[model samples]
Target: MLISMKNRLIATLAILAVLGLATGLIFPGKHAKAETGKAVSPGSRMEAPAKLEDTAGLTAFVDGMMEEYMNRLQIPGAVISVVKDSRIILAKGYGSSNLEQALPVDPATSMFRIASTTKLFTWTAVMQLVEQGRIDLDTDINTYLKSVKIPATYPEPVTMRHLMTHTAGFEEGGVGYQITTDPAELPGSISETLNKHMLARIRPPGVMSSYSNYGATLAGMIVEDVSGIPYNDYIQKYIFDPLDMKYSTVVEPLPKSFIPYQVVGYNSETGSFIPGTPTFEGGFRPAGSATVSAVDMAHFMIAHLQNGKYGEQQLLKPATAERMHSTAFQFDKRLPGVALGFAEKRVNGVTLISHGGSDPMFNTEFYLAPAKQLGIFLSYNGGQGSEAASNLLQAFFNRYYPAPEVEQPEFAASAESVQKYAGSYQFTRHNSSDIDKFFNFFAQLNVSIAGNKLSLGSGSEQQLYREISPNLFQLEGGTDQIGFRTDESGKVTHMLLDMAPDMPLERTPLLDQSKFWLIVVGVLAVLFIAALLGPILFNRRFKAMTLAEKRAVRLSAGTAGWALLSFITLFMVVMSMDTMQKFTSISPLLSLSLGMPILLAGLTLALLVSTIQVWRNKYWTAIRRVHYTLVTLSAVVLMIFFYHWNLLGWQFG
Candidate 1:
């Protein structure tokens, strides 16, 4: 939710800047190439449309669309590959790789970081062990670990199945400082990183899916332990070497041989492409941080679509590959289900077994239709590139396989029940026991009931979901569904959206989503400004202040002033850093920086007592006393908001 909110804020602020409204708003890997399956060489351009056949027409149409979108979005480069019937239908690159040199992208060799898509390879490695009868998907993961043990938080031990489906119940980890520019800063072993950065399991295994990077890395380590080889080398020998994916690798700090093919990612700021640091995910490499070319990725897609066969080599038995695509968990029986490491998404009635990978600058989307023998992969090099990738995929699917005509099911939900479901929901994939829990203040889902429609957020931006059945709603006029779970009392406790039933959002109580807190922030902002100009606005009145009244005024203004400054300082510092570097870089200044909030919280107590003394005095007017009292009350709520979110504490935990 914080990520989505940040992206929306970025778009909003960028648009507002065009209209000159910029002043306000707290907004906020290397790998080697494959030696086999060569199709097009580096610097090869797209072939001109030949006679406009269905394939040729598609090439022309998509090429025009990609070029237009890339220019409009300021993306540095893009690569798209399509495989159908064990053949590469299209593998083309657009735009420039080196913006400085004007080097056009090479569909055959230009490498882009395929973030979390690396999980697919890791999952494949685990399945390979399963085929050899060396690892059990349902067995306790701790049984396989020799280096570190997960804390026994639940009777139900986490299994490889749970880890693959992202239902191991681990909270989200590796925020702020996980990614770095220096390879020397990373841990020597994947196990060492996993042990040091292990996340707390907040729920029993197989109960909820929080999309954990830690769980994925743990699975990779299991492969290492079971195979008696390092994780990266294991992937190379088993998966990469078998598939002849010579240009792809799971290694980090990228091998020197593949360095020439690397495409630099651009950060979109100041309406220009600024070259950003090459991010190394330290210990979190298994979850993401793999680089591969479009043509090599196409070979991967072909193997998966061809029942685990690439030419003569069979990576897995047809049955095993099918098992990998089987539904492991579904949010609702009616919605798409998660298939092992792949997430299930439906587009135009076509089931797309897919996974997307994204880093600070690069984004990747890959989808395969097993039945259709169709696969498409896209990678973009720019900050907002994911947005374009989404648009391109939607347009491609809608143009190709249109949705079938299915009659809409009619049902009515009682207003009482709808009202029960209407409330703010806090995402379960959050830091529950750490200071990161403070992110909840901005990362909340607001559900509103409008007639029979359930709208998310408020006003014009709300996405209305129509009630299709009791506790089941479909995004209005769209196929995706949201399911609400209720207790025996019929009070909604959780909502499952899309395929991720394991990461259902829990309802937030009124206190947690208090509107009064927003009011306090607004009132405090006014008081902060007033304090700066109060004496000038009423100089005569200030001159007549009694010693006690003056002291009271000073205390009230001091607390309010301190709170505002601390907040501004934190926001500015955080917003300025690269998103990945924001959290971890604050360590050097944390102790001193955290003192301001602690002081403000302490001053909140003093300000409250002084407000009481002001009421007892007779020198001040009734209006003055009331104004000061409200300001003091606002300050009290401000401190509580900071304290409740664990912001007042200096510890990151």
Candidate 2:
């Protein structure tokens, strides 16, 4: 059967994910344990550690994994450390300090961009306030929040707890030029940011889970409003100082003292370092914009591992830690049980708490299994860090906790409720470039327990997962509840999904991206015909008119043609890099859509230069030679550019 474009994208992603995690699914020779005395290279199979009970092998495993994963991901550098059994086991670095210089990575003192992981810290501070009775979780946030006003979602005010779990229902804004040119605007106080980004809600607070940076910023706003301290300052005084995380800071402009080992963020296309991703100096630090090494990150993770207590110091009550791990909003129990700021996943039935972080071009993930005394902190500068971490997680479970065999379920029970949601799927972020550093390429499970699957890119879609059996699943949320409609003869046809009162989804592009592009083109066509072509087609006379009529017609025709060509050129240049570089094949005098038009202009200039020589009459021969040379250079440059860029995937048409 022929597959659609959307279906093809899903299949390709499944293959990519499986191919990427090759080692994880099929562990052949070695058991998943780390060996002591004989150090096994990270990323390769390891012999089970002789002293399985000893913490030493686990320590080596942690350090080795960090270095190994960084290289696999092309990360500029990483500072990863592991805290197990309430102690720092390994803190190390791999790859280059600066992507340009390709220097050795820093181990102990290097810094990095920790991105949204900063939210965990921000949540930590907010919870600290909660523990102290300075804030109430369920009360309306606007009561404490000042300096900026939030447009409440409903007549009933939403609570702080709602925003904490990303159920605040705030629609997201595009990043890019804003984050690049005016990162300072992001750092403004929380209330100020709330006022700045107060848009309409997507759903009632706590009804559905939708991730929002603006929500976290508001949490940061309340922390500042009620505590009477700046966001980062609060984190330092309460969390960082007490935890002895000396190297940790919400990096804004990055301190000069940190110049030594700090990794420079890279833009892969230009092969240039991206300086100034602007960590939180004063504002918006809550939603994640911070930097630290594995050592410091390990300390933070270990504290959580030990349940909000470090040594004898009780940073947070053990009960509160339990609450943090427990889902405040079970907005999703399918993909993973996401709580306030963390996620709960059962790897082979062993529950673990995990959170992922990403910045301009860096990623960090921490998974802690308090049940098994296991913790993993993975960091890399490039986006591939997540896949590396997943592989490491597989190795980790193999070493510490091998996949246990499950007794077969009864035949009746196995087949009784075999739901129709089954198939692999992935999620691609909307309205963004491939080079974006945001959490744009978020992993979404297409989950199916039986034979059914969810569609990708549908709006207001509720993505859910339900395990029917090990390695089998079903989608539970709105998007997962897909059915089908048929013709009078009862043939399988259009799909029925729970999108706004359980409506039928047409098999066609009810809201396909290309359809929108077509609408735009249709509008342009109409304007072109009515405003430009219509006049010519409806002209009164055919041939033989006054010179004034001829000139007027020519001027109008030229103006309209130029305008139409301009829009077409812009559209082509933006949509397909394939059309940009041009050769003589595209007509040397082709319009601006193909870059050869510039070369043709150069040829005209060269001819003009030669004609000036003829008029001067002194250096006619020399000028002729010079003109030919100029034209030749332009032609050569055009050809070279077209050839090189085309060879590198810039196709000319």
Candidate 3:
């Protein structure tokens, strides 16, 4: 089989598909855990320390934790700030900011891209206007927009509240222009970008949350329209200035004075740090483009913890700040939900209002425990920074506010009852109408049964979950809760996790599951191989065929050849690129590869006509005719797969 090029290629593709499926089956991706320590019973609580009386002890713990994380995760640079009772307990830096120069990160002056953490400031600016009666949270967003109009796809208009809670129902947008290394790529203003690339509304407003970067940027534009100033200028004037955060700025392309302090973002490969180009968020700046130092971020956190008062300067009224921290949207009463712009979660038996940020090169985590009057912020410049930040925060909570061990509800649902919820689910925060939709193939969450309990992940990372109540499951050894939503027929429609309030997992249809497609690909490869091999293996019989029969055979073989070849090409192209390249811009090679599916769709139609001609005229033996029909049907299935994954044509702008 390896002697022929066609056979070798077919075998390779089959092996790749098998490996991909096996990987997904045996090691499903890890889900965020609710608590990092022992489980806490319902209605129970564990209080965090009231004050940082042992600052030196806390410093030693942090220093040891950061050093271990940096070495283990290969993070070159990071900064962290912690505040308790409106006082900075620790604001420090670790590792090197510039590897080549050996320049250390400065907590007070060194700057790092805080990414979507910038959205908090943008939301703060909006709430400040709301406090002054300049804006209303419930009004339709279109009323204040001087430019760009959100289409009325649904009866309910998207409001500021919906945007803040990520329930505006807009499909994912801002691809190809959200982040860029070139300054010339940016539009003149936020309105120009929004108007040119307004996203399609996929769901009804204020229904469900799906983290939308476009929604946040639109809210920033509304701030500009209502306040009569640019979004960045408004933040600098209202939030930054009031908080006295001198080392922070939302302005793209840092000023000359701030340039020397900016840390170099890095990607570690084979024990070497490779510096990445400094990225700009362009018109999406309001969503995640601000740069700030650890000390400056401490000021912003302290203000929010102290009810919007940092010294004499009050960025938001006490009542408005309280409202911002309160729960504004929740899918289920038992699970964590969204609080205005903040994501609410119960970790270590205490409620935390937090927001996380990530760009290509930087990752950040920000959390505020208003009840404890404590806040923590950390950002690192490395490829694995997101994982590092998550681990650090989990360790911090487990050390200082560990949950008390308690009995958890046992598995009460029968195997039949649990079977109804077992399937693949796709996250709601994905592109549904573009080439970017192809990436969703790898983002599915698989649910299965583990003996008597429900398993909530894929692969080796599966976590056992028990049904504490109907449709609500809790992690066996942790506090994480996963709630399922059912339709009128009691069929599960969506799954909500306590750790990720900004997105929900919608149950995927049987035909649309990734495993289903993988099986189809494997079967199609076999049929296509047979179709191509039949001519060569039976050349003597082929010579005796009539003109019509020969024509039919040639058409079927050609169609199968194109299907196999084009699919392999598409696979190779996608596997070669990373997530950032796929989302940021479409290269020429990818554009051409996407066009191949459209050509294959045409060939499949031609092959279908040939199959009908073979049957009507009796071009071959019944068994051969049946095999040819199977090959033709396989071609049709391939076309359906292409269309379902948004690969039939060029869908990018």
Candidate 4:
């Protein structure tokens, strides 16, 4: 009648877990207060944790890691420095600034594309000006930049804090300055640009953290107007010169200031290294495009380490420096939290403040360990800066705080609950594999009750499904109600899923799993039909042409048309979600359902190319051979990718 000690403990644990689950449902938004470095505020003195552990070893690890990553990331070079206690514990450069000529990178002097790291500098300058009683953090920035105006979406005025923390409601529209896009299309001058784009609110100021390149650029505009100097000139006079950072420059400011060791920035698409574009031509674009060397980066970190002072000159109050490091983006707790222009994460009670930068040809990251007086600056030519930075950080974490292994608990699924999950689900596909990527992509469906919990199905992913009533079960892993609807007699029918709480299959299912390939084949047929029709409609002389000549005409017309369509197809695919990023990323289904037209377009062209060359080519053997060969190759490549992507399936399709 009595339970054993071990069983009692297990039962107690299970009961506690049930109690916890019930409590969680009742009090949903209760998260314990976060731990920061023990009440770190402005004016409160910090007891520095200066326990040094193999500073040189840490340097070698970071440098070696950066150099290795640079080789793969197509980055020209990177400079890294980690300092503690106002001392340079580690500073070095990896890879030549100019990879082609093999010019050496100097840790102390060689320059790099600092990217968004310049925000810290701009913020420092703003804070310095504030301490001197010129600008106010919470005041309307329009007071200084007379030309710039925030859209009157809000009942009251927008403040400088909006621009600083990216709560300014400035829709990015797209990447700040795309390589393919013209700079003319960018926010002309900082003021005009802000006036043109700054809306009152995507969410209320300080309500949600949406990143804004416009906001930071506006700050630069304010710095220029408030200081009565250009943004570049102001930073040079206040931030750079004071810190004695000679190598730091924004955009093309140092166009003529050449260092033989410098590497040109690259265009990501062309895969060829292009020279760096100036971040700001005029007005104020401050969020990105600051070039500096590792040595200069070290100096900047040292200034932060010294609580906003460089050598004898106290640039900002210690309070402001602390403010800059604190959390800035607090919109949704579930999403990654951010600090002003920086990302914040709490690991085992210690808060980590970090930011990553990616330009066309460069990438960079600067991590601050304020308590240890330690900071790491990882800069690279390509986008591998995040990789190197994350790797080094993870390695350090592994070394200092090795996680202890605990026993894995067994999880048993309810068979009756899982039984209801046995039917097919149909929805439009999404562009992103991630649930929220690009908003509503395509419709997705899952049938669970299989032995394996997860598998890579077709071109995308498969989720674990549990049965609820043989045709209705809650999606166990996510926050959605997905059911396999049934016919009157309880027979399985199509799937019904709510991608969004209120979306009505916002993405309607165009291709069921069984018929998706047929649909693709139909697309190819469309191309063929269109190709045939074009010639019949346009080329009057085709009727008079000889058999061989007629064949050549048909192949040529189809090939040319399809080839152009293929190009357009590729372009549209990028715009869908695969490439042309949904800047707002509001709905994932946009690309999945909407992209059907583009996909159908591509398939139609492909079919035209295929059908015309194989069967319709009018016996011009030579033209037919070449045309058919290219068509076959294109089809093979397209199908291979499609099949790989799960868009085309063998057994399932």
Candidate 5:
């Protein structure tokens, strides 16, 4: 669920920035220790093979690591499974599954939600159809659908290849309809649900990578159409049956047999564990609704590592499995890219194909090293599961396949070249035409020149990069690489990070930066406050004004100032809600707040007429008339800001 973490982090940072601005404090800077890139001579290094051979050693390593992570992160329960050379190295569970009942997690029976990792099964099902010549990877996806049809937005049609690599160019959505605790909210059918709420195509097919849940769901529907079976039933019969995975299922409100072994999820954000209500993905189930046991996950991993074969059963042809594991798309050749469905990354001098998943309460990580015939699956239930999984992965790779340090490439760039890349950039996996976009205002990354190197982000999360070649920068002491894309005029337009191949960052224009909008808001705040105090402090001057002048004063200063201030106050309140609450559903309070923009637009139009009248009639001193004009201009600016953020109307849909 690295993608989920990225998206949520952006939103979380935005909220923190706004809160910090209000308190006259921005982000607090904390320097991180630089990574050591010292080389170890071959004779000095350990003689152990760079592969998983000793099961006892792995068990000790994993046990120590998981215990430390559980205590440090306050994670309630977790499961870890490792497979090597088609054999299970270890499959174990740790901690309490249900704190209230003191239930311990059972590796053989306890089922945990694997979130987006479920997409692998969906993709596998598609490959099965491909092997049978029932579906073509390059053909238009619309041809295989019977109920929902993809719109012809661009000249090039969206193909299965685009969906597999997340290059279909669909804008991200699925807020209110993504997950729910109520069974009544489940859609009657996937196609019917898609027909009612299809995402708009924002870019041409096969242009760029942007993670999209809707795109994956569409692929699942294609599987259903080609196989003439329901998606859930198809997976159960073809996959689970062949692998003999008894405790795993994609069905929501778990099948009767699985209910007893289901693990309870927990939220540990408030320094205490609180049981979370069960949530279902409804029609979006195919995208991330798989509840699986760690042992079951090991089977799935072993089959993939063995090239789609589990004992005598062949889930996919050898040739088809090889193609699925090969790289299918990549924005930059120098950066880790995407295979058919797996995200490719190079860690400790070893290429590992992996996928991460996250729900509100569960997090999972799956990794396979084809060269070494090793696979690892880890899942934990708690608020800090993602962080715990990340820590474990880094430690596991460093212990097994230590990287051999090489000489650093030397390259210097002119200050002007470095400055050109300095700007605010936003992730492509975001909403561009909806109220969800408002959160993006706070999620931008600010790049700045630091001596001869470049700095990315701010505060504790900041990372330093040095240029290794033209437009390609490498992390100071790490293997991570970031490449910049320039337009025909040599202006940097986008950046691609080696670790994040599914979402590219686009260079934000000046007007779109939060700093620009914050400055405008600050200026308007001062003007509105002065307008409100002007009449109150100068009562004698106000009484001396003529009837027409008084009317103009009230419209320009009295009504406009209060209305704008009211809208701003309401906006801050809406943004202060819990992150999940904001995404689950639009509250009534927010719905009412959306109408404030329309009211402000009318008030601004009236103020514009008042400004002209005051100038034409010479109602007051020249200074007073000029002040009225300035107030009217500020009102217009506020309207433009509202329009840009999609606050001008009800844009939740």
Candidate 6:
């Protein structure tokens, strides 16, 4: 009645997925529709207007919508700016910037961390250099770098074009120094950070898009090398000054004059505001370190919308700007894919170029519709801002440009055949090395199929997807879709999650995340507890046994117990906050934690010896033999787990 580690692992994941589904944790279904008229206390200052207007009604409508979502999602503050027909339609802020200080968000002047949207500016800078023949998009990136060299893994070198399109094929980087709320822990210079964190190039350059922050930062480094100016200074002098973006800067350790205008980001999990700490994203400053107000971002948007012209301040040539927005890479020919630094998103038949930014305490989104001459910029100050950002963007597209009527294409399929496609899928955009690889287990997704329709997660949070093509499915009543790739034998190997479509996600063999290892740990716990009770409840039976038998029994149970204990200690340390940063800190606590897995491995060997002795002597009944074999197998699995996580030795760093 013992289980195999493989099956147990699968069962454990399946069970966890079920539990997650029951609790609405993982794949939560659709969110609740917004209620504009919801009543709230006067102190919150969120009230909908009594009547809607036809002329300039968007201002009041957006106000009510933002307030409704903020209250419902527990978001403290948000700023939204929309530019339509080359004129500012609305630029407004709603709710409190700091709940404790009771400071209101100011769209005109209050600066919020714009995160990875800074990549757009970085790309713009690269494009500026390209226009002047200062940098070549097709040239190897190493040609301009002075401090670091990308380890050339593939025959074709990484080029500026690949970086701009997010197709540089660099493995996803940024673990320890990406973003933090503490200034004291700021990573060293940009070049140093990039040099230390050069991730392995898993895929060949220009093969597929991976949305690499490292790639963008390297581009910035190239800018610094070519211009003979600091990355921040180059941006301020060329892009910011020309566009009159007086309030925006990528400068790390932000200046004192801008301190008063910077808004404090909130942490929804702890229900507190993060103090105005100067956290630098190190080399990623080029990728996601820009801070700007909605008003200033609007000006930046205006420049892009105007095709590199902001009243004689030409940041880029008109043709160069056009090329920047044009499609640089296409994953699925039918779907809008990467467009240089921008991502092409089609909603309701209109293609909108956009990019989004996120930090621990902020969520920002920027989108521009050239044909419509529309630009939308919004930023929020808390974790809940994630949901708010998505909802706001969806609502805007739905209201302004509704999809045209079209006949739905029928996909022929049998329910039974389609059901085989349902399982847990793991994202490919994951850390390939280091302790982070172990964290991938947590990203397992549970998928379910009904007829030809696919639903992610379970219950109210599940989003419905229907097949638009044989292996490609689209969200029902939505434009986003994911395509499944099949192997030679017609087995599905990967499903592209359109959000980061380039990140490969293969179906997990385990149906759900029941975590079979945990089950083994639980069994060991029971065995240890039973052994402890033997002296009290069955002392007479122990007295009847020979010394050798007693020793064998003690050793078998002891090893299992030690393995479980050591594992728990190691798990706790690995999962600790800032574990990545702490990995290199050889502090006593971490050293002891790192050593636990070695102890577990030693215990595994002792258990194996006991099992071999039991087999040779034929010591007990068939039931006992089976139990010992299972326990031995479980111990082996634990040893493998430790090895898999690189914990068998002190290889954490």
**Model 1, 1-653: lDDT tens per residue?**
12333245335223111111111111110000011111121211233312323787778867866876677667889999999899998889998777877888888899888877888899998998998999999999888998979888999999999998888898764444456677777545788887776788888988765676778889988998998998889888988888778789878888999988888888888888888777776666777768999998998898888888999989888888999988888767777767888877666577778877666678787888887788988888885565566556555654565455577788877666578778888666666655555544555667888886887655444557888888888766656578887889878888877633344678876656646467767777887768646766887887798878778877877777787887777545434544555433445454466677888878888987888788776548898788887877777777777777566765453
TM-score of 5: 0.92
Cα lDDT of model 2 by residue, 282-326, tens digit: 345576667777777777777787888876667788877777777
Candidate ranking (lDDT, best to worst): 3, 5, 1, 6, 2, 4
For candidate 3, write residues 1-653 as lDDT tens digits.
11222122222222121111100000000222334362122211236532256888678877876787678668999999999999999999998888889999999998998778888998998899899998899999899999879998999999999999989998774445557777677534788878877788999988898888788899999999999999989999999888889999998888789988898898777899999777787787888778999999999999999989999998888999999999999988888888889988776678888887766677778888999898998889885565566556665666677666678866578888888888888777667787666655666777889875778544444568888899999877667778999999999999987767667879887766889899999999999999998889999999999988888888888889999988899888876775466546677898889888888888888888988888998877899999999999999999988888888887763
Tell me how candidate 1 scores on lDDT: 0.71
Question: What local lDDT does model 3 show for residue 495?
Answer: 94
lDDT of 2: 0.51
| Candidate 1 off by > 4 Å | 1-54, 414-417, 457-462, 499-503, 511-516, 523-553, 575-578, 587-592, 605-636
Per-candidate alpha-carbon RMSD to the true structure: 7.8, 14.6, 6.7, 15.3, 5.1, 7.0
- Using lDDT as the yardstick, the better of models 4 and 5 is 5
Q: Which 10-residue window in model 1 sums to the lowest lDDT?
A: 28-37
Model 3 TM-score relative to the real fold? 0.91
Per-residue alpha-carbon lDDT of model 4 for 534-593, expressed as tens digits?
Answer: 557856656766776665555545554554454345335534442123221223343344
| Candidate 4 wrong stretches, greater than 4 Å | 1-53, 72-76, 174-188, 195-201, 258-261, 266-284, 332-336, 347-349, 400-653
Better model by TM-score: candidate 5 vs candidate 6:
5
Using TM-score as the yardstick, the better of models 2 and 6 is 6
Model 1, position 305, has a per-residue lDDT of 89
TM-scores for candidates 1 onward, in order? 0.84, 0.63, 0.91, 0.58, 0.92, 0.84
* Native-referenced Cα lDDT, model 5: 0.77
Candidate 3 vs 5: which has more lDDT: 3
Pick out the ten consecutive residues of candidate 3 with the lowest summed lDDT.
Answer: 20-29
